[model samples]
Target: MGVLSAEGVLLRRSATDKDDALVQCAEALVALGAVGDDYLTAMRERESQISTFLGEGVAIPHGTHAALGGIRRAAIAFLQFPEGVDWDGQDVRVCIPIASRTDEHVDILSALATTLSDPAAAAALREAEDVDAVLALMAP
Candidate 1:
């Protein structure tokens, strides 16, 4: 429904989609005060269902259950790796965790996925040193 708080942005020096991804996602959600221990556990369990992948060097590992009273306020998680994570046998680096009940979230992710695929956007995201810089490229 709304963009996550600035605190929700997690700038990962290294992106990971395995068990390590959970920690980074949880950190960002916790910083926003949108996630708790219960939500974290649910998210971890949901990962076993299926792997969230976006072709062209991007994958999103998300939790389906939800946080913020099970309403799914936690919309996304950002975990970027300098090297990359092996996803579905493909090497991926940028990770964005997503959970939402609103259409905006889908739109945003679509835009990001498109951007990540674009040569210019991908280059910029790859070079970014911090979340502020990365957000700038995605910002309108």
Candidate 2:
């Protein structure tokens, strides 16, 4: 197993629910930058062709290594759309954006699965009104 834990993952309270998935994913990409140089732009470029929706009112937007400016680290973000974002077949109110260029990415995904797989966490996130409240759900 990898070192995927809820510590680095987060649940967020987005200001607006009408945000475009592309935009939300891009912003998350910036925060998880490894190359650290214009990572947002690179993320958009990577996202131009694909939708990273993971089903269940959630979307996982991914950026390739080229767009990441190189290096590998998993960045996780929890986005709660007040209304919801149109994604593929379903409307997503919750999104988890993750980017990684190394094996650590696996750990991130593992952590994500472990955390989100919990019914309590998902329920809490849906009900949480603010980032602080969301973070509490992940608290030990």
**Best-performing candidate as measured by lDDT:** 1
Residue 51 deviation, candidate 1, in Å? 1.0
Q: Against the correct fold, how does model 2 do in TM-score? A: 0.62
**lDDT of each structure?**
0.62, 0.56
Error of 2 at 109 (Å): 2.2
Candidate 1 local lDDT, 52-134, one digit each (tens): 66666666655564443553364565666768776668776666665554554676676676777688787776656776776
Residue range 29-60, candidate 2, lDDT tens digits? 55555335455555566556666666556676
Predicted structure with the largest TM-score when compared to the true one: 1
TM-score of each model, in listed order: 0.75, 0.62
Off by over 4 Å in 2: 1-19, 31-50, 71-73, 115-120, 130-140
